[model samples]
Target: MKTVAFYRIGMIICTSSILLLLISSLIYNLLPDNDIPQMLLLRDDNGRIIGDAPFAPSWQFPFGTDREGYDIGYKLLEGAVYTIGAAIIISLLSFIVAFGIGIIGGFSKFRVKSFAHKFFTSFYFIPQSIIAYNILYPVIWEPMEGFTTTLSERIVIEVLVLAIITVPTTAILISNETEQILGEEFITSATVLGGSPLFIFYKHVLPHLKMRLFIIYPKIVIQMLLIIAHLGFFTLYFGGTDVCYTPFCHPPKPFIQEWSGMMGTSYKELGLSWWIFMGPLLCFTVTTLLLNGIVKCIEGLIDHEPYKSKQTSRENETHSFESHSKQEKFLFIKN
Candidate 1:
């Protein structure tokens, strides 16, 4: 199949998965909370009671049951909104901060631009996962003593930290793009005509950046998802982890039922009930792949004409600068 065909196929699959998750969440919310049926309850052959038993995939429970006897399928459905929604929110916030800093720095005087470039360049080298984890650890990690934070508070802190960590790198990218746009002859012409900075930016830069934003936004979402997964692997699930003391003191439990948290909380079952880990792992993999596919589609649709024009304009600008320098040198020699 052609590359574009593959992208289209990916887009379809990804879109369908997202839609299914959305529908599932909507249906789940519509049902009265107390009226929700227990679908993953298990009983012994002689009808003895067993709490939270593990089971493999079967006709009745397609995705199987976790160690807690919760249906993997149901958990996935319930957590989809939080998992995907959080990533989208973080990505959008990142985009806003990035564009704001980037546009301002790109158009600002030399000192501001230089400082922004250097700062982000240095920050870009540090691993984003590490940064996110450190920032969140202090806020999310429950101490052995002192007051504990509420779920809503932890969620707020996590989302804000995740969003903030992305700002520097994203802003650098926007700054570079903005600088290139500023170098174009049209931008210079607009400035020469007494166009205010805001007017010129709105008229010239934003239109060019809109398509670029479409391409970059999905990538930011994917990055956030990966970071969340990375944090999950470390048992630092979003919304923080809860302490459990039943059947011996177990590891902290995830407060949110999102896929990453589910995977983190259920990781202990990897040996006993592999299905639990696999279920959320599969969801994370498929969701990220779908996002990646969408990105490829957008990339394929990107118009190269603007890039070509930008390149040409940059070369013209360089030549003009050189010519102006030569004239200055000739005048100095004549004097």
Candidate 2:
């Protein structure tokens, strides 16, 4: 009960946070103009550029401002959609690839399954971040001729690359689960009864796969988030990286203002204004916790075998009683 309650609480908090982000994203996008100020030109009586300098946390700006005077809070709000949306898209795409491969491969002959297992296993040892960065670099890196890729194109490519990288691991997991399900007596009985493989799969396998997907989907999202963050730490931001060649090669900046990129870009300023990086870091940490909470909720919903067993037992008892009562009534009426 305690465990169940914890999961419930976590679900509420996480769901709320996710919903809040979605709403904020919606509102931010709906606004006519939501651009971050590259330089908020404010001056004192002495005619100094006060706004360009970083400021500590204050009542006016709760989260503080960065070196360029961009509001950390506002940037977080703007970037929330990109960060969360990218993770979601990557997770869904990965799941789609995994589901197709896992189901087909799991149901395939032993030789096919063995081949696939070996193929995917070979890539599993490689780090996901490295794979993602390598896959994304060519597409995201700006060439000397100037910007060729649009934001949408870069984002789409990044999502696809991220999704593709996870397919092997996710497919392996799904294949294992499907194999276990195939070994069940019902599946064997269906096969013996002359049910076609497709028929049996549709009737008996898809439902189980759906339930498994519910539990695994959030985990995939979390994994993608970690990978994105890792890539950001290496200065490979989502969308693309913009490099300035003038004046001793400035650090590459993210095309879009994402939370991970925010942390990466502002990491150098931690000594002067810790809040710049801390705001996004806190956002990432909280979002991760909330996602973990969601995972726990999913586990709680699907993992309670004892409760399911008890419910099934009670249902069987009720059906038996109903049948017995009907028979007794029929006998009495005949008499």
- Name the top lDDT candidate: 2
lDDT of each: 0.78, 0.81
Report the lDDT tens digits of candidate 2 across residue range 1-335. Answer: 77777776778888898989978886997799988654456688999867655877788678988877777889999989988888988999999989998898888877667876988897778889998887888887776676787989888888888999999999988988888878887667556655577865765676566667777888898999899998888888888888786788868899888988998898887887899989988888888888887887877866643444335434533554465456653334553
Worst 10 residues of 2 by lDDT: 305-314
lDDT measured at residue 258 in model 1 versus the true structure, 0 to 100: 87
Model 2 clashing residue pairs (backbone): none
Error of 2 at 89 (Å): 0.9
Error of 1 at 246 (Å): 9.2
Q: How displaced is residue 159 in candidate 1, in Å?
A: 1.4
> Cα miss at 224, model 2 (Å)?
1.1
User: How would you encode candidate 1's per-residue C-alpha lDDT over 103-219 as one tens digit per residue?
Assistant: 988887776678668877987688899988878887776666622778888888888889999998888898888889888877886676556788667767776777688778888
Query: Which candidate leads in TM-score?
Result: 2
